[model samples]
Target: MTQQERRRGRDETEEERADRMWGELIQEVRVAQTGVQILFGFLLTVVFQQKYASLSQADQAIYIVTVVLGACTTGALIGPVSLHRLVSGRRVKPQAVRLASRMTFVGLLLLLVTMGSSLLLILRVATNNGYVPYLVTAVILWYLVCWYGLPLWARRKHSSDG
Candidate 1:
């Protein structure tokens, strides 16, 4: 059967759509949260490293900003858990799912900043090369393409005909 003919309530009832979307959203968050948590955890310990004390003032400033971004990433990623816990029995899964999805997106954005800044600090310290900024910019652009550009492109390319 064609797409329209096989659908009940436009391919799914509200509850069904919510359940499916929530499951998918949770899975995506799990993937994002794990990476962010690991990176954030490592960022948390940087200040204790003996090398951290020797960093230039500029590098230290960069490290601080990176760590802050990492913390934001962690919070946004964990936001969904609190959301689910608070709304579990309230029959508001659909809205919860939407809000969680937005949080996850914000979390991903923060993760990108965390990663880009971390890379910048590392490369600057490790090489002190004049080309580090260019290299970091390239890496950031690559990340933008992979993490955001492709997904957005696909979303626009394959949207439903509604």
Candidate 2:
């Protein structure tokens, strides 16, 4: 095959492709990291609020779970930077990119759950209506469709791969 044919999507060598992908991955991670940081920080202060003492046992449990999920999400989103720092100059850029990509995907999933849990807690505290779970479920479904479904559909429909 010609050199161009071997390059497939881009006219770059494997190392060059890895470099580009790593840069893009880091940029994506930065956006997610900012959001998760803000959310985790907010979650941390929730226990100090006077209203926290009045929360029902179930709501308190939910708050604890949400805070934990926020922390995990923050860790996952920040993981790529640490991965790159440790793996840099180790001749494993491609592997690092793949691993970081996986971490970012997991981070996004965790973020979705965290946001949903936070919303559930907030809405439940705001009202004692029976429709809270249904409302939260609908919003979670919307998030899943927006974050995963559309991207997967585009990948399958538009990509060269079968």
**Of the candidates shown, which would achieve the greatest lDDT relative to the real structure?**
2
Worst 10 residues of 2 by lDDT: 1-10
Tens digits of per-residue lDDT for model 1, 76-119: 99999899999998999999999999999899899888889999
Off by over 4 Å in 2: 1-7, 160-162
Candidate 2, residues 8-115: lDDT per residue as tens digits? 667788899999999999898888888888888998998999999999999999999999999899889988889989999999999999999999999999999999
User: Best candidate, TM-score-wise?
Assistant: 2
Pairs that collide in candidate 2 are none
Per-candidate TM equals 0.91, 0.92
* Model 1 poorest 10 in a row by lDDT: 1-10
Give the total clashing residue pairs for model 1.
0
